[model samples]
Target chain A: MAFDGDQLSALAAVVHEGSFDAAAQRLHVTPSAVSQRIKALEQQVGRVLVLRTRPCRPTDDGEVLVRLAGQMELLGRDAMAQLVPAPGASRAAPSSRRLPVAVNDDSMSTWFPAAVADLPADVLLDLRREDQELSADLLRDGTVMAAVTADPRAVQGCRVRRLGAMRYLAVAAPDRRDRWFADGLGAEVFAAAPLLAFNREDGLQERFVASVVGRRTTTPHVHYVPSQSAFVGLVEAGLGWGMVPEVAAAPLISAGALVEIRAGRHLDVPLYWQHWALRTPTLDDLTERVVRAAAKALRPVRRHGPPSTAG
Target chain B: MAFDGDQLSALAAVVHEGSFDAAAQRLHVTPSAVSQRIKALEQQVGRVLVLRTRPCRPTDDGEVLVRLAGQMELLGRDAMAQLVPAPGASRAAPSSRRLPVAVNDDSMSTWFPAAVADLPADVLLDLRREDQELSADLLRDGTVMAAVTADPRAVQGCRVRRLGAMRYLAVAAPDRRDRWFADGLGAEVFAAAPLLAFNREDGLQERFVASVVGRRTTTPHVHYVPSQSAFVGLVEAGLGWGMVPEVAAAPLISAGALVEIRAGRHLDVPLYWQHWALRTPTLDDLTERVVRAAAKALRPVRRHGPPSTAG
Candidate 1:
């Protein structure tokens, strides 16, 4: 079935701007006009697409339409970029095309900002911070066009490219290391020494501990720190020991502010750039930038088997 | 009717750990034992408290019990601190008492970490990051024991203390200012200049623009960069003009990398510390630390009238 571009855009704007009035301002239309378009679209779909909350949210049915609208808007901008500009003249900035992408906090704090800083003035980014292991879910549900994910397997209808592996070292402040694990990574140390976690969803520490102990065990004393920079800061402050990214930990470790809890024992989490398998220029450009950034910031991934597969 | 402490702890642990098996490991009990305790608690309350999701979540009723459990645990630790420690002897660390609090990103990246870093080794922190304006919802819903909030008005059953005001300046890279507003702040600037936002929920830029134009108007071109440091970095990269905290912007401004779009017309977001009125020692200690940090980092709030109030 064919849908009107204006109606789809209106529906997308309402969900994006969070209210009918705000959507009107965004689309340069009246609130009544936005309301009429939404109502008409709902009538055509025979399902209520939006929940009239304080910040309007897309219902499950609405999510499908929102994804469709976002794709159309991206493609339309690409078309404009190609068709409107004359040879040797600068391309007109396609200012309003928002590209939604999901990335983990660690990368967000480290190398991701560089990729974003290099974007053309025309394309705006809508970034969502999610755990690396879980970011693929955003792509599956069409909430984002691209994601930085830990899982090599991609969501259906998406393409995945290996973005190398992020290496984490188990480290602690010098004083904390002396006080807690003076002897070594003994079994008793796991139960006694304080450990830091990014959040409940963070399993990096657990994986590191499991590698050492050969079993999944919970640390009785743990601090749940959510921010990327703060997690490293806490470890540097002698609060707890945690798995720190090698790139972030190297300078601190050399400076005597931090020491490796166990030398040469590390966790390398493989990362992938997963995005919708469409030939959109913006998405393609982003993928190239992400792959380049990953190459610079992360350790190269080692593959053992045949590589090419549908994501 | 009196609620069992063991049952309450079990319920809280299950919600925090996100699974019955994980909660069992935390409580040092069998999974069946954890299940029985939850079932008994539900039967006594005559309501379903926990939803059996992949990561178990609290129902509205469960949230009430979770808050109760958290408060009781804090009080229990406070009592133990007094009773268990003798004069001139080192106090035993209460290792597992997780203190959940809500803080905004700007504060979290700056002064807030100092407060957390100073926390006694025993007290663990579970921080929830929300916008200063919306953080009070976590307090109202009993999801957080305390919050750094924008609103002076306190949540129900909570006490409010005037922390201070966080001042924000309208800033852009020197080059960006030269290109976009060569003539200075004009009616056409708001429509033509690209603006930076923390996210969709971030209204600081809009507020700044409205203040300049003497009315609310949309910036047609905008980029939403969510990270605190990244937002400022983008402004320095000549991507767009944005409302940046004065503390963060000052260094860049002095270095001539960033310039004020409009000087002396800054927005001051008055912040407050709101927490449950109950006299728990850890909460009291945390409040003092928060107040001290705010005093050091933010400008003092100017009171108008009627200083004392409930949150």
Candidate 2:
């Protein structure tokens, strides 16, 4: 649905702040006007975007449309910037919504948040995470204009660059490692011992185990530790050992809460920086910083390696 | 989704091809309105897109909504280069297509005749192919705006890069690699056996065993042969251990003489490249060369990796 500049800004404020009242105060518009614009936007899309809940949250469909609105704005601004071939493209009129960026949870736990620490405050930041493997889909669907992904391939109009690897280490609490070792923790110990996964869907632990066990199981009594900090906390507390990104875990390990379970065989997830293939300084700058950081921090792999037939 | 540019073309031909009788003969136009609008479009897109399509084409979409009409002329011109851009941006006046390109097979296999090579062929130069992993997608997607690929990434705006990747290999005729030590090969002896994977999937024999046996299927499939020339015919002729990419296999392997039983892992597929993000001469210069070659040579990835997960 197309929205003119004024109308879109008003609606975006209302949605982000969660209320016509709050949005009105922030946008310096009357609450009634904010209500009118949102109603109009909803009518245009033929679906309700805001639910008017206590603090208000968008419906799943509403979020999708809100995302679409955000993309259209980007595209419009980009069009203005590129299509008109002027020396310095006029600045995009400021909007309250931050440029949404989608990234993998692991990267988010590592350098992603830090990447944003450098953005202009007015640029705003919208962060989303799923998994490195699927992050590009967000770019395809226009959920975000930029993304940190495992897939190096570009989306229809996106640019791609290597962001290096996100190395993972198999670590455990110092006492727990010794206990498992002393208790005859053979490979089979993995089949029976308590394992910690970030969530019901997280497979890092299972995959790590299978890499060592040679076979995987469908059922295991697993402790679900959802957040990055929480997952590390659980591991630090010795709930069970899990694979953790070296970046975020190194500092914690030095404090004596955790210890490396095995010294070799790190899992390196190659990461890539992908963004709309537009000629915008902000996007380009973000790409440069990300690529630089990944290069400085992650282990590097030769561009072409001896071919293999294994996953 | 299909537009009736043919009707319009035939009609336009009636006037351009001139003498309703000749235009009708050329366009199979029934003569009446073909004569009428031949005069009309001269007014519409504002230029004579086609003087004739006796096997003829267009003047410009810029003059009007002549997208399909202009695209046909552009594509015909590009049967060689790669693509024609928007109906709007013709610096001075739209003209010919140019610069032929090459690509691999896989990308061509999936992108269909279109995919990345979706741009019209308003320029010149025939699209061609050779490798399947590198520039094929660039050719297909117009990334190199051109390429030859196996499983290589499409050059951003070009067609295919390499077809991306297809792991191919060689297995001897009993006497070839091990002096009749053939059939007894299924177990531990295969990893470092006189193995063959022309480029990389050579450990394939061992990988096959791994699926049938273990993950660290300790086998050493031999050397990397990057060229298709040595990969296939060389392997078929019973040369020392050789692994070939998939595209080169069919004819020779199908003949029932050569046998490749080596198996170890999933072929590694990695494609990469970058292209001019904007529609410019250099970018266009490379696209057609890539896609045309991809269409004729490459194959597709069996499945798109799962729908990319988005936040």
Candidate 3:
């Protein structure tokens, strides 16, 4: 069944604001009016749209509508901006468009801000920092208009472009290397060394270990530090050996704070830019800027064969 | 049916590593051994425990076991530490413990690091940065053992203690204030002005608006910038007016880079320290350090009523 945009927007507001009263305030309507709009929409959809809890949560069905509302809002704003006259010619406020994008934490801490800085002033960015592997879910669910994802496959109704690869080197502080690897970079030593992980989801270090030793073995003693910057700090402080991004590792490697564990082993996580296929000027500009930045900051995608000699 | 600790751990490893092979590697066993352990556990439990996806996700039953495994591991580690001699007396890895804790982004950017600094060298912190309002979800899901949360209510089997209130003031760049509020803080002007939000989950600005206008209403224009530091920068750059934490805004206020939108108007979000009721030395030390830091950094919890003179 088709739903009215206004009603869907009201429903989205309720879910976002958490309470009918707050949603009413956000919508500048009376609480009763907000209630009426939601009730009407729920009736139209013939499903329970929201779970009226302390922080109102959308039901599975409600989520679909909320996602639709967000997508429509984004597309509508972009379309309006395109149709409207230039800011100089118009008497209205400057055309400020909100672009919700999901980004992985590593990129958020490193190259993502530069890409954001490259966007036009009128575009307002709403960045959701999530794991690269999970960022595609945001695009699929319409929570974000675009995402920098590790998933090379395009989400339904989305376009994907290769952004490039984030290369990581297994490194450790000199003290840690001396202490943990006194014996050599064998399977036993790699398995025993205190390894650092970004989080439970992070498998880069484990993958590195598997590559070193033909197959997965006993888990290494691990210290999980989820922050992008702090993960590097822990390695520098001799806390644990970890996979450091090539961009962040270079200066430290040269400065002697960290040394490569195996000398030649590395991991390259290829990243992609995924966005809705609806083609908006804002999305186009953002994709262009991101593609340009990734080209300079990340390893280029090899057309034929693997580029890294290390792995 | 009772499940053995080994089997439970195996299940947790599978869920944690996201694959049987990875879990087998982590458990330092053959993939077949990992499979057999899981198969035995499933037989004992009489339920399908895990959904074998690319990155394996736990079925509802699997999550219960995973949570149990995590809790048992934590308690077991703490018990071992208690039984064992202190670091100087023992050579066994110095009783290193990993404490996965959730903290708000604002806290992470500001006072949280100092609190982390106070943690003992042997206690490794696995910090997860989440919004204060949502951090409790981590505690609930057993993803973290503790959290600095806005919700004062205790999660199941968790203890809650008042940390203190984080005070936020509505502020804007001088030019923004002058241009947007030239006619004063009227509802129309407020509704039209660009506002900054941390993300979609942020309703603080909307709540503040309702408080100012004395009713619920339509949402004002918003620019969502998820980073705490970047949100402040956006406000400073005159991109939007937003509520800035007192700890962060004070220096900018003194520097005349930002002006309080409405004098004395502020929002105080009372934060609490929530942790598993299972008392452990590491958890105790962390709570103590966090509480001590919050006392110095946050506004004291008021005994009676709201303190802000504006609202």
Instruction: Supply candidate 3's per-residue lDDT for A6.
Output: 82
Q: Of the candidates numbered 1 and 2, which has the greater TM-score value?
A: 1
- State each candidate's clash count: 2, 133, 12
* TM-score, per-candidate, Cα-based: 0.84, 0.39, 0.71
DockQ of each: 0.32, 0.01, 0.20
In model 3, how large is the Cα lDDT of residue B2?
63
lDDT (Cα atoms) of all candidates against the true structure: 0.79, 0.51, 0.77
| DockQ-sorted candidate list, best first | 1, 3, 2
lDDT of 3 by residue, B1-311 (tens): 56688898888888867799999988899989988988999998899998878788788778777777878887777887778754521123545677888887777666666676535545667788775236766675567889887777788768999888888899999987888878777677776777788877787887787788887655546777776755776688777789888988999999999999997888888888989887667788888889898999998877667644244
Off-target runs (Cα >4 Å) in candidate 2 are A1-3, A10-97, A120-144, A149-161, A183-187, A249-257, A301-311, B1-311
Model 1, A1-311: lDDT tens per residue? 89889999988888877899999998999999999999999999999999998789888888778778878878988887777552211222443466888887777777777777767767777777765236765775466899887768877768889888888899999888888876667566676787889887788887788778777775766788777667788788877899988888999999999998888888888888888888888888888888887898988777864431111
Candidate closer to the true structure by DockQ (higher is better), 1 or 2: 1
For candidate 1, lDDT tens digit of each residue in B33-74? 999999999999999999999789899889888778877877
